[model samples]
Target: KPNSELKLQIFIDTSSLEIFINDGEAVFTERFYFDNAPQVWLTAKAQCLTQVYRLDGQAITFE
Candidate 1:
């Protein structure tokens, strides 16, 4: 069986995030900041997974 998985690794020091799909096939880098945001959240729908992290946090990992 071929299962698809999305992994999001957030690096707080650089204020950036690295997204990997199915290990290493697809990758995306994004940078964001929220002055008044709550805890991180992971949401998944259909065949996609997304991770939301706060800027104050040290790091975040999603699998």
Candidate 2:
């Protein structure tokens, strides 16, 4: 689908990173060891929508 939409989800924890694309149609996971909060960057070839979320305990906020 050329004009179809995509859903992306990301989760970051103590030593892990998880990414889900298109409702879990594709997934990427990695283990990271960081002394502090890690920096993440996402890029796309064409115009796309992006959102960032911060989760604390059970609350999620847009940042």
Candidate 3:
């Protein structure tokens, strides 16, 4: 499949999280509860660049 440029916004609530991508062009909404707070993980390939950000304003670059 061809890769498309995407923008994702993740909203974290007490009981669920909502992910909106490309202004609702694509969406993955679900409810998840873990004993420990979960971390966000992103993976991409084929000339992909990934940038990760934490709620605390920390950012990391990934390949």
Candidate 4:
């Protein structure tokens, strides 16, 4: 299937990263140590859609 659409989701947390493809059908997770803000880079051909979101308001606090 050459024309199949690809879906992805990227998540970055305190010390780790997770990437989900096809709406969680597949995922790639990594762990690293960083003390500063995170950054992103994108490169694709054939015009792909991109979305960005913040986890500030969507995160839950357990007290």
User: TM-score: which candidate is best?
Assistant: 4
Q: Which residue runs does candidate 1 get wrong by more than 4 Å?
A: 1-14, 36-38, 44-63
Q: Give the C-alpha lDDT of model 2.
A: 0.85
- Compared with the true structure, what per-residue lDDT tens digits does model 1 show for residues 1-63? 245555656444344556566566777777856465324555655566555544554558789
Which 10-residue window of candidate 2 scores lowest in summed lDDT? 50-59
Worst 10 residues of 4 by lDDT: 51-60
Which of candidates 2 and 4 reaches a greater TM-score?
A: 4
Off by over 4 Å in 4: 57-63
User: Stretches of candidate 3 above 4 Å error?
Assistant: 46-63
lDDT (0 to 1) per candidate: 0.56, 0.85, 0.72, 0.86
Clashes of each: 0, 0, 0, 0
Q: In terms of TM-score, which candidate is stronger, 1 or 2?
A: 2
Q: Cα RMSD (Å) per model?
A: 9.4, 7.0, 10.0, 2.9
- lDDT for residue 36 in candidate 1, whole number 0-100: 52
Residue 36 in candidate 1, Cα distance off native in Å: 4.8
lDDT, candidate 2, at 31: 97
Candidate 3's TM-score reads 0.57
Per-residue lDDT tens digits of candidate 2, residues 1-63?
A: 566777889989888999999989999999987899877787876788878887767657899
Per-residue alpha-carbon lDDT of model 3 for 1-63, expressed as tens digits? 257777778876555788988899888888878667767777666565655555554558899
